[model samples]
Target: MEYFTELFFSGLTRGSIYALIALGYTMVYGIIGLINFAHGEIYMIGAFTSFVVATVLSIYGFPLLSIVLLAGLAAAVWSASYGYTVEKIAYRPLRHAPRLSALISAIGMSIFLQNYVLLAQSSEFQPFPELIPDFDFMEPFAHVVGSSDLVILLTTALVMVGLTMLIKFSRIGKAMRATSQDRTMAMLVGIDVNKVISVTFIIGSALAAIGGMLIASHIGQINFFIGFIAGIKAFTAAVLGGIGSIPGAVLGGFVLGLTESFATGYVSSDYEDVFAFTLLVLILIFKPAGLLGREAAEKV
Candidate 1:
């Protein structure tokens, strides 16, 4: 039972991280119908940005909390800029093009970004310092909630809650919903569809950036190739929960994370990736559009 408890908590922590990143994927796809395959690279870039910021601040004798905050700020800025540029350059030009063409462009952009990171940061893994200090909890059950785990879960939950409120009440959020429902109608209603898309990208990228930082901190290292599988997993979570549903993404992330963790714990760590992928397939077969996803009815 203790071992099961450990796995459950561990899975929740990982799921929280996955959910954070998955939010970005669902948000972008909901708004534009573009997959943004390069989003994972944005995650990678954020982690690297955090790493660099931490290195620089360490020289100045800054505390761990201060350094992490600084890193998050830097990562957010860099990811926002990158997302803006990507939408403007790669996606905007294809806005009116066929879906296949836009998808091809996204793939090309993803490849370009991957190579860019490889050239800039190298392919090797770089170790990172632990941002949160470790301490024993007074309660015996506290072992289930390690410092890093607490941070991941709390940060993700807070961010998710804030995001839900933003989408529910903010002016831009209304515009986004308008655009998602019908771009032409949104434009007629005096909303700048392009601006809405841009804002969506910025928000999604920032979320992914935070996820990257948390993941790197959790694992104790960052690498150029780290985004590949993580991105796929996040995308899967988004799909599992209902790609266009914000709350769905969060639910799916936790589900996938918990499942993967327990599967690895009991089934076999070596086949963890396979198990995750298999689960995705199984979910898709039964739910089609996803657990929370609504099936679109064809118009006559």
Candidate 2:
């Protein structure tokens, strides 16, 4: 029981990070049907940005919590700028082209960004400051759960709730939804489709930035190449949950996380990625629309 309990928390912690990144993947796809492959690179940049911020703040001996919060803000804002630039340069012009063109552009941009970061920062792995506090409340059950895990879970919950509320109640949220469902019709109804798309990119990038910052802090290390693998897994999560569904993305994240955890715990760590990708393939084969995804209508 204790082993399973530990595994559960571990999976949830990982899933929380994946959920954040997957949300970014799903939002962009939902709004424009384009997979922003460069998004994972954006996440990498965010982690680096936060690291720079925290490092500078640490020299001043600020509170741990203040450093964490400020680091997150800096990461989000900085990465959001990259997101906007990505959309403007890589995706926006290709929007009207064949879908393949947009996909290739994304791939090209992903490569460009990866190399750009590698050159700017060292190719070596960078360590992140451990800002997450280890809570004493879980000391008795430290074998099963820890303060760090609790923080990850709570942070994810707060982000999910806040994002849901924003999408459900805000005027911008409605516009986003309208543009996602039907771009032409949304523009006809007076919504600025381009603005909505751009905002969507910004929001998605910010979410990815947060994920990158939080996960890097938790793991204590990051590198320019981490984004490639993480991006693939997040994209798989998006597909598993139904790419366009926000709730589905979260569900898929947890499901995929649990799958990886159990695989590593009960089986071999070497097979973790294999197991995750296999599960995604099975889900795709069995339910093409995804667990929570709706099938799109085709106008022949």
Candidate 3:
């Protein structure tokens, strides 16, 4: 029972991280119908930003709480900037062009960012500082879950709730929904479609940044290539749930995380990726639209 509980919590923690990144993918796709493939690189940038900020702060004798907050803020700000720029430079131009063009651009951007980071920073993994402190209250459940895992789960839940409220009642949220439903009609109705898309990218990028920092802190190491694998998994999670559906992304993230966790615990860690991809393939085969995604008819 203890082992089972441990695996459950572990899976939940991993899922929370995946969901955070997956939200970025889903939001971008929902708003612009373009999969921002470079989003993973945005996440990697966030982690690097946080790492730099936190390390400098620590050296300067800053308090733990202050370092965490500042690092997260810096990560979000920088990541958001990169996301907005990517949209304008790589995606915006190809908006009206064939979807293939936009997709290729996205891929190129992803490759560019990855190589840029590799050249700027070492290709080797860097140790991430333990920004999250051990909580006294969590001592009792220490065997089943660590303080970082608890923090990740709680933080993810709060983020999800806040995002839900933003999308449901906020004015910008309404604009986003309008834009997603019909970009042409949204522009015709006086909505700034471009601004809405930019905002979506900003929000999604910020969320991914936060996720990157948290997971890096949890896992204790990071590298330029970390984003590639993490991004692929999160993208899989987004597709698994329903690419354009917010709730679906969250659901898919948790499901994928749990599957990986249980597979590692009972089966073999060597086949973790294999299981995740196999599950995605099976889901796609059975329900092409995804678990919560609805099929749409397009005019030819």
**Most accurate candidate by lDDT:** 3
| Candidate 2 CA-lDDT value | 0.91
Model 3, position 269, has a per-residue lDDT of 99
lDDT of each: 0.87, 0.91, 0.95
Cα lDDT for residue 202, candidate 2: 91
lDDT tens per residue, model 2, 1-300: 888988988999989888999999999999999988998999989999998999999999999999999999999999999999999999999989999999999999999999999999989988788978777777887778777778888988998998899899999999999998899999998999999998999998999998998888888998899899889888889999999999999999999999999999999999998999899999999999998999988889
List candidate 3 stretches off by more than 4 Å: none
Instruction: Tell me model 1's lDDT, rounded to 2 decimals.
Output: 0.87
Tell me the TM-score of model 1: 0.96
Between 1 and 3, whose TM-score is larger?
A: 3
| Per-residue error (Å), model 3, residue 18 | 0.7
- TM-scores across all candidates? 0.96, 0.97, 0.98
lDDT of 3 by residue, 5-120 (tens): 89999999999999999999999999888988999999999999999999999999999999999999999999999999999999998999999999999999999999999999
lDDT of 1 by residue, 100-149 (tens): 88788878877888889889988888997787667567256566667888
- Looking at model 1, residue 45 earns an lDDT score of 85
- Superposed Cα deviation of residue 90, candidate 2 (Å): 1.1
Q: Count the backbone clashes (under 3 Å) in each candidate.
A: 0, 0, 0
